[model samples]
Every structure is written in C-alpha cells, then in structure tokens.
Target: MSTHSYDAIVVGARCAGAPIAMLLARAGANVLLVDKATFPSDTMSTHLVHPPGVAALRRWGLLERLEQTGCPAVERYSFDFGPVTIAGTPRPIDGAARAYCPRRTVLDALLVAAAVEAGAELREGFTVEEVVADGGRVTGIRGHARHGSSVTEHAPLVVGADGRHSAVVKAVRPGQYDERPSRTAMYYAYWSELPVDGFETGIRGERHRGWAAARTHDGLTVMPFGWPIEEFHANRHDIEGHFLAMMDLAGDLGERVRAATRESRFVGTSELPGYFRTPYGPGWALAGDAGYHKNPITAMGINDAFRDAELVAGAVADALSGTRPLDDGLRDYQRIRDEEVRPIYELTDAFARLDPPPPEMQRLIGAMHGNQEAMDAFVSVQASTLPAPELFSPDNVARIMREAGADG
Candidate 1:
C-alpha cells in the first residue's frame, strides 16, 4: 500500500487523459495520469483531424511533431452523403488548415510521450477502484496496481479525462453527465500492398469512404456508417464483410484492399454519441471527451481531445499560479469546453437526423453540398468552432432555400 498526494491527479491516460496531464505537468504542477491500458495500444477511431482541431494542435506544438511522425497533411475533405459527394478545402472557416491523416495509435502515443517528457507520472495497467471525497468534495482516488496492491493518491484536484466510459466520471459525475446516442456504429482497419485510386494523393489508403477522410496513416483506409444499433447488430459480422466488399467494389479501392500485404485487424464500435454537460464540482473537473463527448459523425475525436487538453492546461496553470480558485478555474474549464462543443454538436445532431431529412436540415445540406467553399464551412460547423448560424447564413444558405423555392 502506498499513499501520496499532489496538486492534481488525472485519471485515464489514453487520448483524453494523457494530453490533459501533459498540459498541467508542463505548467509545473505535480500530476499523475492513470490508465488501465498500456501505450501504443490499439484505439478505435476514424482518425481524421478537423481544421480547428489541427489548429489547436499547432498551438500546443504537437502539430509540428505529428508531421514529423509520418502524419500526412490533409487539404481536401469530401463527403459522400449517400446522395452527393461534397468536395472542398480542408478548412471550415477561411485561413483554417490542418494535416491530412494520421492513425489514432500513433497520434495518441505521440501525445503520451509528450506528456511524459513534460514531467507527468504515468501509471498504466492500474484500475481505479473509487474516488475519495472529503465533505462532498473530491480529494483523491484509489487505484489498484498490477499485482492487486492497493494504492491511494491524494490531490487537491482530480480530473476526469478518461474517454467515453470514464471510470473517473462514473465515480465523480454519475448524475451530471447526460448523453444522447448518435445511432451510428463504426468499423475500421488498415491495409498495405494495395494502391487505392483517388486516395494515392492523401495520407494512407482512404477514410470517410462512406462519410470520412479518404486515405490516412500508412495506406490505411477507415470507413464508418450510421446504422441503428439493434438493426446493425443483426448483421455485425456481415457489416465488417460489407466494409471489405465496398473497398473491393471500386476498381482502385478494390484492387488495393485485395492486394494488401499488411492488414490491420478489423474493429467495430457502437454508441458513439453527442453527450455533453460535465459535472464540475469543488476540487474536481472533467476534461476532453469526459466533458464533451461529441458525435464522431464528423471525425472530430483527436482534434477535440487536443483542444480539451489545452483548455484544462490553461485552467490548471491559472490555479497553480494562485490567480484562480480551483472551483472557479474548473467552471471556467467547463464553460469554455461547453461553449466550443455546442455549435458543432448542433450541426452534427442535425446532420444525423437526415434519415428522413427534416425539411430545414434537408434544405441546409442540399444547399451547401454543391459549393466547395460552403462545404468547407459546412464541415467546420461540425468541427466545434464555427457557429451554427455560419452554416445557415442567409447568403451561404440562400442558394438551397431558393432551390427549395423558399424566398425571403
């Protein structure tokens, strides 16, 4: 048994946790980032970075490092909305740009390494048992080390950056977190020895083939589909086979998938949602996906996580400097994160409702799908920065409403 305390203790060390821990550590706070999994582990994601997300990385100095790590620059983002293929510049707003494609495995590992370098103590392969609270305030966490040895760590602040199903979140914000499912499941993998057509220019193979990036990582193509869970479960394995079938359906995409010498294991995930609203209490705060786990319909995971890390870092930095109260700093963290995600989630949730194509949303997508500049901004709206009205701007959206014969 061991007992120790710090200024802050962050739970979960993967995508969300690691980055937040790194940010606070670099600011000179004693931080510990705990994860149940080891580094370089496989994570499920479409792995496409959005414009604002990429910009956030550049601010954190991770963009330069990612480019140095075989990450490709992405200049084009096209969407095959099952009706039309909307192709546009990679940025949503003007002067916005980001790198093309990088696998989550590599991206996450890079962030973790950066966190370690910044002086964060990472405790992997450890299971969190409970959160320690003092008079209605969270003060520490109880984690079981690998050998089942019990360890307790105290901290004035405890951060929950632990991804979607965060254990720390469960311990802290059980009632404050509310989320609505996006009704979409994702399946992804990698391939080599296959030359993908229309994808040779991008990063790896292709992404968002159905609705995401074309090629990213080392010739790896990721595909995601929006299907009702109960219905999708009936043909889950068949769905994986269907994904392979599509890659083989197109001549270039087909030939590449068929001839690949290296193939990554196929993975599937369901319940990717647009759950926001975190619980920020005294001496405790939520970060990353824990704070605002948005719908992945736009593939905003990596960049969103990076942005959250920065948000938390700035807040923690302020608290450490005695310029901010811990609770006040946390509420600031919550407010900023919520504000950033609200607009994007609005667009994403509205986009997901296209099965019946609600009149207004139908008009929106129909109007902008043809304009490349509009399309870039369209994607930007789903990216967590551009306001929702920007997408529905009278001038920007006038074309569609005109086509629908709705004037004035």
Candidate 2:
C-alpha cells in the first residue's frame, strides 16, 4: 500500500479517463490517472469523431493541438443506400463544423498530454489488480507497475474510464441491463493513396451490409463490416477473403480498394455486445465504454466517450467539492448519459443487425435524397448535435413533405 491520497483515482487513461482527470484537476482536484498502456500506442477503433466530439476538444482547448498533428478535418459526409444517396456538410456544434478520424496513436496521446498539463498525475504501465473497498465503499486501487513492485493509491472516488472490457467494472460488478447479443462482425484496414477527395462516406450495399471510408493518420481507411453473428466462427479463418468479398457490396469503394495499395494488415472483431451498466455505486463510478457501449456501425464511440468524460468530470467535481452527495451527483450523471445515449444506441443496434428497414423508414430515408436540410439534420443526429427525434418524428416528416410540395 502507498501513503499518497488523491481527490480522485481514474483508471484507463484514454479518451474517457484523461478527459475526466483533466477536467477535475483543472477545477483544483488532485487527480491520479492510470493506464496499462503507454502514450502514442495503437488501439482497436474506427477512429472517427463527429462534430460534437470536435466541440468537446475545442472546449478543452485541445482541438488546435490535434490539428497541428496534420490529421485531416473531414468536412463532408455522404451516405449511399443503393437506391439513393444523402450527402451534406456536417452541422456545426458550438461553432465547430468538422469531423476527424485521427489514429488512436495520435488522439489518445493528445488526451493524456492534456490531462498531465492540467496537473493530473499520470501513471502509465500501471495495471490495476484489485479495487480496495472498506465498509462497502471503494477506497482506492491496488496495482503493480510493469517493472516495479506492487503499490496502492487511496482516493474517495474511483473511476473506471476503461474500455468495454474494463477491469474496474468487472471488480465492482454494478447492475447491468439492456444486454444484447452481438449483431455483426467487423473487419477493416488502411490503404495508401486511396482517393477520397476529402470526404467521409458510409455505403449501405446489398443485403444491408455496411461499409465506411475515411482518411486518417497516415492513410485512407476502409471498413467492410456487418455480416450476421452466426457467420462469425466459420469466417474467422479466411478474414481477408471474406473482407474482400464483402467489399463487393459497394462497387465504387471496392474498385478504389482494388486500385489502392494496402498499407496495413486487416484487423477486426467478431464480438461486440452492447449494454448499459449502472454508472455509480457507494464510492466508485464508470465512464465511457465501461458504463455503456453501442454498435460501432454508427461510429459514435469516441464522441460518446468525450461526452461521458465531461459529464462524469462535472459530477465528480461537484461531489468532491461537497456541493452534493457523491451518490446523488453520480446518479444524476447516469440519468443524463442514459437520456442522451438511449436513442442512438437503439438506432445503432438496429443498423448493426444488417436487416432492411421497414417500408416507412425506407421512404423517410429516400426522401432525404432531395431535401438537403433534412439530410443535414439527419447527419447531425449521428454527430450528436441534434436528438434523434428531431429528424425521425412523424411531425418532422410531415414538415419535410409540406416543404417539398411547396418547392414542387
């Protein structure tokens, strides 16, 4: 055990942990941020960040640093649904109007750096072995370093900002709900000199298969994903062949892939079950994918992490400052995150199933082909600036129809 004590001890210092620690430390809390991995390391991810995430980085004053790394800012988004295409610029979020797809190596390091700059103590390569609890309340964490002996750190509040398979959540075992089976297997890789013309695109091909393309860190990325869960085991052995075959779903994207040089080996996952866990307990809390995860088909994970970090940071800061009881503030954090994420989670789950939408839904999407405002609003929902209902409600559809009729 160690003698040091902090206002907060945050585990898994990436998108979620770093931001939470940075915000709390910025508010005059002594925060300790720990992560198993070192800075500038790669992690599995789609790497896409929508406009709202861009806004969060701007709020933290890190967006300019991210831009300094030369990660391109994607200004346009296009979705192809075989019969029609909806294309538009992303809607602005807090005066920011662009998306990004920087590699994890670039993004995570930046976030960690920001946390350190904000006066948070970061302990990289420290793996948490257990959660130390006393009188039914989490008191701290016990872990060892990559090379040093075992150690322990004390704190009133412990946060798990780890990814979906968080050790903190596993130890605390908070209430979990909305559990669902995996819907699709995903596979993607990078290519050099893939011509994208400065746009990010999502293509829905035959059989409802989904494809995504964007320019990131060093190359263009192409992900051909969404085969049903049942095919996972049988297809694991021939991932490259299956990946190439799936590329045929988008002929244009497929042709580009065939022409471009492969810059990295294919990587992917067949298991991504979605769920929501209670965010807090007596003295512990969860943030980012540790508390909730949705299908990546929507490319919302990074943005969700940013938002979660901000929420958890604010609530924890209030609790630590004695403005509110920790449990009450943490519970409010859970409620707010649920209300914000539930809609997109459901929509992403449905899309991940790779099934055709109902006829009415199809009509609504088809209508977006001609309505630029509606199309842009729909994209904004994906970016998380606007709520889902604003673009999907019956009243909204009627309004779009009336406007279209007037234009005609």
Candidate 3:
C-alpha cells in the first residue's frame, strides 16, 4: 500500500468537508480532502441556506459566484398555516437578509473549487475503507480512488464530514446524545415553469401535512411535501399521488404546480433521526451532519453545515498551529457547536413531528398576522437569525397581541 502524510485529512468533500479544507488550507495547513463522488454531482437536500449561511459564503468570497449561477435570492418567507398566512422578511444577519436555494450540483462544485484553489489537495472518487488508529488516536485513513489500488494517508487529524451515516463515526464509535427516531418523511421534485416569489412554507394542521417551495437555479422551483413518519410507508408507494394531494392543501399552489413541468424525478427520505454525536476524540473530529443531524423540516442542514465548517476549521487550525492543545480546541468546538444548535435542534424535532401547535403558539401566530413587525420577528426566528425565545418571550408576545388588537 502507498503511504502519504498531511497536516489533516478531511473525508466527504461536500458542504462541510470542502469548507473545512478550504479554511484550513487558507490558514496555511497542508490538508487532504477526499470524496467518493466527483464534483457537480447532485445530492438529496432541502437546499435552502439561510441568511447567516449566506454571510458565511460572503465571508469566504463565494457569494458572488453563487449569484452568478442564476440562483434566485429568496428575500421573503411566507408561512401558510391554512387559516392564516404570515409573510415577511427575516431580519438581516451580517448584511445578508436573503436566502438561496442553489442546486447541490452547483453549490457543492463551487465549494470544492474553492477548497482546491485554497491549496487543499483533492482526491475525487476516493472511498475510505478504514480510519486507521494507533494507541486509541486516529492516525490516518486507508482508502482508494475508484478503479485504483488502495493507499494509506497519515495525518495528525482526521475529520469526518461524511453525513449522518459517517464511516469515521462508525469506526470511532462516538457517543451520541439526545437521540430521537425519525419524525417525518419528505419527498420533493424540481419543476420547470413553476415560479415562486420567495420561500413559501405551508402547514395543514388538521391533516398533519406540510410543504415548502423555493425558486432555485435555472429558474426552476423545488417543492417538498411531508407527512408524519407513521405514514411514510403508506405514502412511499404513491409519492406522486400523496405529494399532489398535499399540495392541494396549499391553496392554488397545486394548480400552479400542475400547470408546470416536472424537470426531475421525485427524491425523498424517511430516515432523518435527530441527534448530536460527541464530535471529537483523541485525533479525530466531526463536522456537519456527521456530528449533528436533525429533520430538514426547518431547512437548517446547509446553514448549520456552513456554520460548523467555520467552527471546526478554526478549531483544527488553532490546534495544529500550536495555538492550543488539540483536545482543548476540539472540546471548545464541541461545546460551542452544541450550545449553538440546541435551540434549533429542539425546534426542528418538534416541528418534524407534524403535530399541531400548542394553544399558546397558535395564539401567538394569530396575533402576528397582519402585523409586519411581529411577522418579521417570526420570520427571523424561522431563519435562525433571531432566537426563538426572543420573539416568543412573554413581553414580546403580549405586545404583539395588544398591537394586533387580539385578545391575550
């Protein structure tokens, strides 16, 4: 077997891995980024990146590249809860008030190019066969390119950005906490000639159904419909039928969608499980869905991946550059990551259940209707630019109720 060495090795070169490798190489670290899939490949994703994620791209100097791809910026978010539709703009985060739903083929390639440009070595189509360890410390990886002989690469650090079913995670056997079973199943398709003004989400509380639509690259719209996990089996057999029927619950969206042409096959999953894994060990670390995963109902996957990429990259750089101990740096990364995502994790778990909102939440949503400020705050909460607690605080909720002339 061939042997090589680097300062760090990153697995799964998509959203999380590419950014982590890019940032580390930018920090002057010798990094190796490997992925089983070649660039421009599509993956299943909600594809929505909120304002904070947009800010991350801007910081990385890739926002303009994304814009040049003809992906539309979603400046408004509308939540249709059957009885009331609350539409408003989320508050800006770092001068980014808009979201984008770029196709994964475009976005992931952009990221991989950035990583390569930053001097990270890329091994496309490399599949990891083993995460090698020595004395309980991750030492390197054994993998090979498609149609090639297996080779070994050693590094002080091995990072897994390999998604929920991470090979590295399986090898390291990191402890997981707050584990929950799948709560919802979702299916989506891309359609041509179906234009949406911005991001639109609909909830049919009575039917325990939800759907969302957003305009993406090539002027196509991507729409997803979801149901409780209990119904996943029944619905999987007739995805088109159930999808169209759910769209019918969203007013005229069904009519508009019917008038459009489907440009892609239906894609979906019912395996979403909410949990956070212990992200770091002696010489290994996790980033993105490899460490934390939750339902895509809130559309937070891409955004959170961007955020954690920066965090893990910074942590690894600090450690490798002798700014701190590796364990300390990774520990800090774990703590901060957990603290940052706990709120949204809880919110996503609850929403994924497709249960009707509690009386208080229903009342709060009702009070926000027709009230621009309150609705904006609500949207901000959904975008994760503002904390949910801030908007749902007793004082804020009461003030909104009073201003909207709704009974408390």
User: Candidate 1 vs candidate 2: which has greater TM-score?
Assistant: 2
Clash pairs for candidate 2: none
TM-score: which candidate is best? 3
Measured against the true structure, the TM-scores of the candidates, in listed sequence, are 0.85, 0.96, 0.98
Model 1 ranges off by over 4 Å: 1-3, 92-96, 193-210, 244-262, 353-356, 359-370, 382-385, 399-408
Q: What does candidate 1 score on TM? A: 0.85
User: Using alpha carbons, what is the TM-score of model 3?
Assistant: 0.98
Candidates by TM-score, descending order: 3, 2, 1
Strongest candidate by lDDT: 3
Candidate 3 per-residue lDDT over residues 1-408, each given as its tens digit: 545669999999988999999999999999999999999889988699999999999999999999999989999999998889899999998999999999999999999999999999999999999999999999999998999998889998999999988999999999999998998888889999997868999888779999999999887899987999899888888998888888778787778898999998889999999999999998899999999999999999888889889988998888877898878878888898888888888888888888788888898888889999988998898888998878878888889989978864
Q: After superposition, how far is residue 286 of candidate 1 from its true place, in Å?
A: 1.2
> All candidates' lDDT scores?
0.66, 0.84, 0.90
Point out the worst 10-residue segment of candidate 1 by lDDT: 199-208
Question: Root-mean-square deviation of each candidate, in angstroms?
Answer: 4.4, 1.9, 1.1
- TM-score for candidate 2, please give it: 0.96
